[model samples]
Target: MEVIISNYPEELTFPQEYIDNVKAAAEKVGELYDVANGEVSVTLTNNEYIHTLNKQYRGIDRPTDVLSFALNESEEPEIEGEPEVDVLGDLVISVERAEEQAADFGHSVRREMAFLTVHGMLHLLGYDHMEEADRIEMEEEQRYVMEQLGISRDDAKEKKAPKAEPQQPEADKKAKHKSGFIAVIGRPNVGKSTLVNTLIGQKIAIMSDKPQTTRNRIMCVLTEPDAQIVFLDTPGIHKPKHKLGEYMVKAAEGTLKEVDAILFVVDATQKLGPGEMYILERLQATKRPVILVVNKIDLIEREKALPIIAHYTSKYSFAGVVPISAREKMNLDGLLDEVKSYLPEGPQYYPEDMITDQPERLIVAELVREKALHLTRDEIPHAIAVDVDEMTTRPNDDVYIRATIYVERDSQKGIIIGAKGSMLREIGALARTDIQNLLGSRVFLDLWVKVRKDWRDRDGILRNFGFGDER
Candidate 1:
């Protein structure tokens, strides 16, 4: 299960343990409902953002503690083949509201946040509280999950205070903070970007079905008052075919020695192939603790995943093995718990609000490229790269971005442009929405398509497009 947490507000700060609580809460709900193969996107935002969403979607002017948008209730598009990940739905949580309510109720914010996450996940699973009977059942389910997670009011009694006071803040401040860097390395297209995006609670890295989608080593930060985990989302370690491929492989292996730890993510659905064995062989040389992340467990049953887990465990002595659906956001709290055990006491490496080191230009360009990937077919090829020629703020505060999508063939350019520029328009419409969410402002995206033949093989051209610099 994949539990993606996206913190929208830059200034939102809280204890990192609350994230574990959130994941645990969501996982408990899954356990109760027997939903092992599911995905839940948990978005942490401020009242301002939630208020906007509430007004826009629910016709409510005020911000709510949580809002549920279950895809199960809607008509989700089905892929041609069997789906690898089953998306449960989305949960929009207002952190500001949760904090306020926690104070009002005289409980710790961790408890309040956990309740909200569990309550929200339940709603996404079709549990409702409109009627008295439904309300009773829903509350009972909530209590069961909380109890199962050992986070019930009774379970957390020692952590609670008589009243919210300055002493609690002081105690929190004095608590030892832990911070570390963990590199997320895996075979190509193993949901590394999805996992990182979910962990950071934002989409800083571009994601697609295409192999070698992530060409750069993206540094994503997850911060809390007590802990900060900076993640290095490296390119998939694969055999290189060109300069760009060699650079990608080199860049991925480069981080193994420098990072405090590593997350070796693999697809649970795929057999233990030579590519995976190759990565495991490389891991043999690294003394850094490596946590085996069995991703995409949603595609298979728990019983089936056992043998896959066994296959990898027999090959290498991992620091820990965590089965998760990075797309569904499942059991991530347990994964974090294992990570926390390895973190050393240290200073917070980055500010609480900074989520990623990628500049706006790169993110914007990647967003466009991701859209192009989604819009085009195999005939177009994966030889597309986006360059943001101009990105400036206009007088009215809207971002004016002029970007060009470079393809290897004229036919590919035509495919992206379409017969009447329809495809480009569609891409812009889709990419603009994500750009707005990322930028938090209205954006006027101007996109162009051009042919850059065999740029992947050319060193200067590849470097210009933000490749070969990872070392």
Candidate 2:
């Protein structure tokens, strides 16, 4: 295939390795379709450049990783006597979007670029993903092409995003870089973890309808062009019912003074209750600015959210009030704009590839716990705690994880294990799917149920579980 390259994003320095990977991917696609003699054009861009194209051509204002324009959409005879040209249409890849996605997926920019190139080439080859069958086929094709390139998800290493390091001066870089921390806090089940996951474009904090799902101070980072926001997903702030609850409340409250700003999220579906009032009172105690995030606005009428936003604004002098549906990703840009205003210009605190500070084992444990919370009964969820006993990689690059589910009672254990270990299998299956996504590898999850007998109230157990530092 004769691959033609267009101007790249000036801000990104494309390495020869990445360019070779892109070409290899396109050639692989062309060879499979017997289009080895055909011609194709590839254009590299950034989010700002692609946003205009997306808005103009596809009517989408947001930046996407890749956009394809297939030439064979229609056929028309030329008025002049001219020979037909063997050409596939344009393929535009946004470097910024690709970098963000690469970081989110725990892969290198080179691998992500190759994957996007393959995806766009398939589109030009008249393959689509508008339907389920087509999507599966396209995905299979993408997987095959990536495997041929030897940069599949499992093989991707931790590499920095493609950048213009030599071209850009230090003074310009200093002024452009912005990085800081922003703590997310609110009442239980207010979609704080969901908001963190949504903003980060991946799940670092586990989500559950049950209160106090996030028991730790999870640091989820969002890295954009010249900006990085560290989000501290704290445990929900509520009246303590047990030592665990006290630990959660303290962890949430302790973060107020240590961060750049606060995101005090509230559910739009419910009225201002005592729980919200408690959070509001706590916010008043903090000197840091708080951005009132009225989340879950999709559950009610758009107009109904106005009062909820107004009510919270009246309750306290929030730095900014952004009514957003974290689950639906509504008005999140406004939320980030408000957040970025609070962050000071500084050097990037974390590596571009690092999304969360939490280790693999902890994340795996949380994923398992999240699945248990979703699968079990209401009473069993609060009592359920997951501990990963062992985590090791097999010779074939697959992961082997043995974890135990600690519950307060033997009956709860029976409920989790189910008849003939059906429930255990179900939990492992569900958790394995998420763990696989999180790890980017096949996971073999082994689950066991154990009776810890009111571990939540016991400080020894709580300490063992990494929650004994409660004040």
Candidate 2: misplaced stretches above 4 Å? 1-175
Clashing pairs in 2: none
User: Which segments of candidate 1 are over 4 A away from where they belong?
Assistant: 1-175
What lDDT is obtained when candidate 2 is compared to the true structure?
0.82
Q: Least lDDT summed over 10 consecutive residues: which range in candidate 2?
A: 167-176
> What local distance difference test score does each model get?
0.83, 0.82
| lDDT of residue 209 for candidate 1 | 89
Whole-model lDDT, candidate 1? 0.83
lDDT (tens digit, per residue) of candidate 2 on 1-471: 888876566555665766777788888888877888877899887888988987776445577778888886365344577655568888998877877766555557887888889888988888876443575687788778777777766545644575543554656533345689898999899999999999998888999888889998898878887588989999999999998988888888888878999998888888899999988887777888889888888899877877777887888998888889898999999999899998887644543445777878989999999988888858576887888999998998888999999999889988899899998899899999989987777889988889999999999998888786843
